[model samples]
Target chain A: MKTARRNKLKMNAFAWMLLFPSLIFLILFTFYPVAGALKTSFYMADLSTPQPIYIGLDNYKGMMEDDVFWKVFTNNIWFAVGTVPTSILLALLMAVFANKIVRAKGLVRTAFFYPTLIPMIAIGNIWLFIYTPGYGMLSRFLANFGVGDINWLGTQSLVMIAMIIMVVWKEAGYFMLFYLAGLQNISQEMYESAEVDGVPKWKVFWRITFPLLMPTTLFVSIIALTNSFKLVDHLWIMTKGGPDNASNLLLYYVYEMAFKFWDQGMASALTTVMIALLLLIAAIQFFGLDRKIHYR
Target chain B: MTKKISYTLMYAMAIIWLIPLVWTFWTAFRPKKLALSPSITFDFTLANFSHVWQGAPFSTYYLNTLLVVVGIFTVQFLTATMAAFAFARIDFWGKQLVFVLFLAQIMIPADILIFPNYTTLRDLSLLDTKLGIMMPYLASAFGVFLLRQMFKTLPYELDEAARMEGCSLWQILWKIYVPLSRPAYISFGVVSVSYHWNNFLWPLIVTNSVENRLLTVGLAIFAQSFETGAQWSEVTAATIIVIIPLIIAYMLFQRQFMNSFIHSGIK
Candidate 1:
């Protein structure tokens, strides 16, 4: 029994030795920054004020009062609402067709999935050229309908819409893969029986396919939601959070505060807030997943 | 008739999806003078690619990107492997809680913690280096989680048999566990490589100089919105250049990429 205890202790030490590398990194990068950002959020600091003064919650107060903050917050909500559902719907549709289509199956899948592989910077840049006035593809296409002369990225009203459209185009293909996987999990026998039963294709999809894909939908929703928050790369190219802070999402707003403005205090505050929101989203995902295991 | 109509509709949608890419290619190769004519022309040129290639330090950018992606993966594969082995095989102290913290790290990715991570790298004086971009990302929580799950599935008898044959842990892992988990490794490697390759924001934040500039950042700078006649032509070329390798890779390994995405989601 003593030797067994010694062996167990030795095993623990060996395991820890193996885990040392990851543990060091996770503590420094993930755990330390989380704590550091939370601490820094309370201080008053910026590019000018390198030495931060401890001012409890002043940064948060300032953020709450800041009009741009409110604007960007609402804009992000609008962006998420605008983009996620549309992308998911398009993904479902694309998955249906991609899974079913006979001719050009490879072509269909490639067209839908390739954009997801492209960098957001390139996506934004390509779309930037596409939205260029007069000579741009979008302008030219609109001109064919005699509805030209809209400044896509310049106008506050149109900027979010334009960003949303571009993002949806970039993202729908990615979400389609998830839905496609979910579709495959569903037995082919069910579909065969559905065909024999003469139930309409639409009904078969809604009644049979959609219900079974709840888990994927839930999973994809979190990814889409988090992506809506985390995705600020395109903002750098497309609008830089816009003509007048119109297209700014929360992540870009944090970026603007921290990097562009060099307001360390405000950046920290914003970063902490984002960490909170991300945690909240993750909590929702875990709780939803938990319910599946325990209740149903 | 309905089936034909729907197939035609789906095919049309597919073509519509392909247009942006095709248009980018067309604009990229077309003669500089007629890039914006909207009138179809047979005229084309490789000069746009050449001009942009010369105009920016693209070769350095490519090298930097390749280094960062490969460097991050090499470290991640090793670290993730070690951590996963421990988690899967060992009854370590506080394993459950430690794993929960790792999961929390995943919920908020290293990318989002740019502000604090910048400071962390700054304190180390590693900013603007490829290592800075790769540092915080060195130990991937997602990777550790993925590999641990894969490791858990291997039969225990192989491990015991190897141990009986006087194999050390390294030998067992290298000779047995690693070979058996090739599918998982490929899936994770593909996902990680593509993610870091296309990664813009974190690398964008961390690196500043021409020496450390990545493809996406270099392209972002090169493709700035100056209203010159040759803007779209060159911009499309630069864009295409940035995406071409990934596009080629996707074309060759479409099945693997798609399978990785699927398995990653479901698993």
Candidate 2:
């Protein structure tokens, strides 16, 4: 009995010893910072000042009242709404067709997925050239249709659309792989049966394939949603969230508030809200979809 | 007939999707005088590459990016392996709670935590260092979770058999656990390396100097130097230089890269 207790104690010690390295880092970078950010969100922190003035909900109030924050928040939602569905649909289309193609499959798949592997900054730069007026590839292409040169990135009305198009192009191939995996996992027997019943291809897809790919869709949606919030890297290169903040996104706005504007309190407040949204979606992804995924 | 149509459509879409990249390559090689021409210029020149090289210290940016990504991956591998072993093999008090908390970290985007992390780094006097850029990512919940899942699938008998020979817990992990989980390590390593290589925003925030800038941040800044209204060829060349290594690596390890991404999704 004593040996059992001692053995348990020893095991516990070993567990802790192994856990310490990761735990220390998690605490330093994640848990501690999150807690600190939460705390700072309630206070007015001036970098020049030695002490932070505790403002108690003022930052939250400021965020609610700030029109730019609302604009950025709504712009992020629009970006997500604009990008996620189209990208997923394009991915599914690619995956379905690519799955059917036997010859040159590797070449086709590589062409689809290659953009995902490149750095977004590089892609953004490439797109910046595409959007450049009066000789840009996109402008020249449009000119061939007798359309006048369109200021793709510079115009307030079109910046977000331009950004969305670039993101969708960059992202669709990535999500296609997930759809491809999900498609491959689906039993061929189901498709065979659907065909035997004289079902049309669209019906086979809509009834059999789409329903089966639900989990992948959910997972990809969660990822794409979070990515919409997290992926402001392109904005730094392309628009700087501008033509009057039309392309401003939540994460970039938080960045602008903190680093560019030097408003840590506001940034923390914004971050707190962003974290809540991410956590909400993550919860939905993990817990909401965990039981529903058909692993076969 | 339907299959033929589908194939034709897929190929057309693929080419269309590839146009930006193809155009980047096209623009990068075009003679400076024909950089903006609608038609492809057959007058390919290395001048754009030379101009790009002269325009920025891209070599330094490459080195800095390599250091930061390697630093993050090395520490992440060690920490994740250790933590994953603990979770997989050891049953102790609060293990579940600790793991849940750790997993919760995965949900909080690192960018959202930037301000506080920046403050923490500043207080530690680690700001402006490559280590600072690497610090927040050193402990990856996804890596820990992935390794733990892989470790759990290994037979307990292997560990017990090693233990019977008087092998310590550490030795058992190093010998049996680590060796068996090579596929997991590779997949995780690919994901981590690609992610850190392409990561821009955090590195942009953390590193202030030209010397400390990673390739992504450097490319952004370089592209923004709008001295010439249409230095498209030079800008594309710089962009290509930043991305070409990854492109080459992906081409070499095409199957492995795709497999890693697919396997990462399985988690």
Candidate 3:
């Protein structure tokens, strides 16, 4: 009995020894920064205040009044709204298409998914040329059909549309992989029985496939949501949140404030907001959306 | 039939998807003067690729990116393995709470905490180093969690079987759990390697010098071709240079890559 107790103690100590490195790194990088960001948000840490003066609620107040913040926030919302469902729907469609056709399966899947493998910066560089007006690919192609040249990336009203189209192109394939997996998980017997019932292809998809794909959709939605928030790398290449902040995202704004403007307080404030929003999304996924994503 | 229409639609969409890539390849290979020209031409040259290659330190960027990706993933595998072994088999206090806390990394990914993490690296005097670019991601919660799940699914009798031969915990983990968890390792490995390979913002923010820059950031910086006259050829060449390795790898190992993504996602 004493030996068994001693063995347990030995195992306990061994476990801590194993976990020590991970614990230290997790603290320094993840937990500490999150806590540090929250604390820094309350101070006045810009150039005017050389010492990072403590000022409660002032930073938040300033953020509320910052027109740039609201503009970017609105842009971000519109970005999410524009990208999520469209990409999800397109992904589902592509997955079904890829699943159905064997002759062109590999080629079709590669065409859809190859873009997902390319880094966003490269995608930005490629699409920037594609969206350029006058002699650009999209414009020149449209000119073939009697359309006037439009600056896709330079114009304010049209930039969001351009970005959404590019993102859908970039991301739908990634989500399609998940939907394809979901489709495969549906038993062959289910499809065979559906065919025996004389159900149309679209009707079978609507009634059977779509509902069965809810769990995958929910999973893909979380990835897409977080991506919408974090995918500002392309903005650095294409717009820099430009044409007068029309394309600025929260994270990019945070970058401009912290690195460009050296406004640590505002940067921290924005970081805190991003962290909170992410947590809210995480909370919703875990608490709220989990209940709704029913599997067949 | 609906099936025929869907198949045709699929082919059309596939072609639409291929255009940007085709455009890039066409612009890349064609003579520089005809890059944005409104006429069809078959004249091709490799000058743009050679020009872009000479203009940028792509070799250094590739080296730096490869070093950090490998370095980060190597360290992650080590840390995740040890941590996962402990969480899965060893008796430890606050295991559940600690595991939950580790998940904070996932919720607030390193990409989102760019500023704070930059400051953290600066404080460590790690900025501008490959290690700096790698430091924030060395211990991945996702890896640990995935591996822990994999380890748990392993039969307990294997551990007992090894232990009966006077094997240490290391022996049990090495001989039993590690070998059995190859699929999970491969899944997490592909996910981790690809993520770090394509990661931009943190690396961009941390590493400033040419020697320290990764391919994505280097490509972005080298894109000054835009201000010059219709240098889209050179820029697209540079873009292709950065992406071709991954594209080629994908072409070679398509099934393995796709299955890794699918397995990782479902887990």
DockQ values, each candidate: 0.64, 0.68, 0.66
Arranged by DockQ with the best first, the candidates are 2, 3, 1
Of the candidates numbered 2 and 3, which has the greater DockQ value?
2
Could you tell me how far off, in angstroms, the CA of residue A211 lies in candidate 3 after the best superposition? 1.6
* Residue A198 displacement in candidate 3 (angstroms): 2.5
Best by lDDT: 3
The TM-score values for the models, in the order shown, are 0.97, 0.96, 0.97
Native contacts present in each candidate (fraction) = 0.73, 0.80, 0.79
Off by over 4 Å in 1: A289-296, B1-5, B228-230
**lDDT (10s digit) by residue, model 3, range B1-267:** 766776788899999998889888998999988887768889989999899888888999999889988898889989999999998888777777887878788889988888888888889899999989888898988888888888988888887888789999988888788888998998898888888788888888998899899999999888854683357988989989988988888899899889888877775
Q: What is the per-residue lDDT of model 3 for residues A1-296, given as tens digits with 9 covering 90 to 100? A: 99998988888889988888898899988899999899999999988888988999899999999899999999999999999999999999999888878787898999999998889998988888789888778888899899999998889999999999999999999999999899988988888999999998778878898898898999999989999999998999999999999888899999999989999988999999999999999999888887654210
lDDT per prediction? 0.86, 0.87, 0.88
Candidate 2's chain A scores what TM-score?
Answer: 0.95
Indicate the residue-level lDDT of A265 in model 3.
88
Which regions of candidate 3 fall more than 4 Å away from where they truly are? A291-296
